[model samples]
Target: MTTTRMPRSGSLPAVRRAALVLLAGAGVALSPLPAQAAAGGGGPSSAAVAAAPAAAAASSAAQTVVSTALAQKGKPYVWAGAGPNSYDCSGLTQRAFAAAGVKLPHSSRMQSKMGAPVSRNALRPGDLVFFYNPVSHVGIYIGNGQMVHAPRAGDVVKVSSFDRMPGFHSARRLA
Candidate 1:
């Protein structure tokens, strides 16, 4: 005796239908791709992958620099020393950068010698900006025209408006 199977109503061939469903699901899952990745049609686009780490690193660095600076707020101003007790303008920047694994010189004048000079308009969080006619003071630019610095001998480290500060010079990026 011979036996044969009958096709079910509205049902597709088992193997082909399963494969189609899987493909459709996959297509749906990957639909509406992110703008950075959409150029490649599917899968992770080069731009998206590349930008993610760069953005993350930049954010991490910014956070590290800001937090490091803020943490030292209220520390007395000690000349030429980057430490728990005190810091000068450049010294605070140096220690903050050091906390983020970037090394910098102890003096503002010396620190000014390193890194490309960035204009005030281009300043970003973590960029070091100098002040005073002789570049005697330095501060970490915290964006929005503000900087964290050891302002004076009596005053502790604090954030202040860069506009109000004197002798605005250039900025240095340690990262």
Candidate 2:
């Protein structure tokens, strides 16, 4: 019986591929991709199929983080607010990650220290971007160089270009 072959690893979506890599790095078992099969023996092994769910879950979590944050756009920016209506910089990020089952501190500086540091160029949707010297402000990256954030006391939650934000302290990947 001929089994259907799976796509090459390189062809997987960026998020899924990244998840697979992370799961592998975390010591999750994974079988070789169909492309790695020798000769005509090319199909997804049971282990390869088994690893797909975890990768998909990771991708889903990232999307949830992004969607949750984006939903708060236009909400008022209130100091120390972290809820269904208004939010502060770190509050918005904290709430977003929480929707995806990831816990993040309520302070931008503390959140900055939670996940793996990501270079500006490596940012993807759902990454947490920070600003200022001591990382006093935070935002959720939503791709295409745009991030959702609570700018200040008078500003509402909105999408802004990370490149234009003054400090550009750093970015971190939590999902």
Candidate 3:
């Protein structure tokens, strides 16, 4: 089997990098990791992260998912790539959420049935927003009515407004 990797780009600051390792080693499970970023800035990692409200952690998780998704913008869309360089619609969403400690199915139709149903007017960041009948496609909601998705076989990962996604099916909040 082939594996995908992302060469560390040094895009994240040194402290955040250290935080990633330290927290990952501590088995902190990257759930809403703004706590790690906060801790990296010098406060006690455990206390700072632990004291954070549940909502803060969840919000951080959502942000983490969005950032992870956006990082792949311009990556080619592959039919079944679940990757560091290329991805399919559901593959992109699965990878992003997994980075935030959420597991997802690879099939868009399966994913649509996994998370709690959310209304169009109530969509929030990190929600799995699906499109097309039979739910052939999916994307990660990034607020302001925008989503990051792998549109198709020839397209790259990109951010698009709601109008760009036809067959606006239901949204599901997984994080």
Candidate 4:
């Protein structure tokens, strides 16, 4: 197995370098351990290297989903409204994921069951965070314990702290 070193810090912008490092970590995290044996050495196998691009793709998709949802910030939260204008909780998530080429149901309850269940400690940007016992509300997590959500009627889409929201039922990762 061969390894490549990252470019010197001076060669890349801080943000770009950080992203590369994070994506590389993501690749390792996503790679199946069983495939590491194919290399016959200590380094990542070809299978792990191949999985890197997939991790990058998923990262990009998650960014898109988060950005698309954030772009709607301040839009009125109309019940069941999905769109270029207003949005409901699920509508916002559905449209946001749709922008990333992933289809999600318009109901929070149904959408909650569509992705891999994620633990609170594992929450990442683009993970769906649900609230209430029966999961009546949903939000797109944006990391740092913050989430973007469309609160009920008379409210607008906004970034909110998890501490402000009650009844945290569960979370899921779709991207």
Model 4, backbone clash pairs (residues 3+ apart or across chains), number: 0
lDDT of candidate 1 over 1-175, digit per residue (tens): 1122222425544543343234334331111111110011111223432332211123444456666776776677767657767777877877666554345667899788665567777777777788766778888877655677888877777777678887886777654
The lDDT, on a scale of 0 to 1, for candidate 1 is 0.60
Residue range with the least summed lDDT across 10 consecutive positions in model 2: 34-43
* Candidate 3 TM-score over all chains jointly: 0.67
Q: CA lDDT, every prediction?
A: 0.60, 0.69, 0.68, 0.69
lDDT of 4 at 124: 80
Worst 10 residues of 3 by lDDT: 35-44
Instruction: Please count the clashing residue pairs in each candidate, in the order shown.
Output: 0, 0, 1, 0
Q: Is candidate 1 or candidate 4 better by TM-score?
A: 4
What are the candidates' C-alpha RMSDs? 22.7, 16.2, 12.5, 16.6
Compose the digit string of candidate 3's lDDT tens values, residues 1-175: 2122222637455544554444445433343222211111111123432343212123655777777777777788999989877889999888887775555678999888865689999877778888878789899887766777888888788777765678988798755
Q: Cα miss at 24, model 3 (Å)?
A: 20
Q: Residue 78 of candidate 4: its Cα lDDT?
A: 95
**Cand. 4 TM to true fold:** 0.67
Measured with C-alpha atoms, the lDDT of residue 108 in candidate 2 is 96
Among all windows of ten consecutive residues in candidate 1, which has the lowest summed lDDT? 32-41
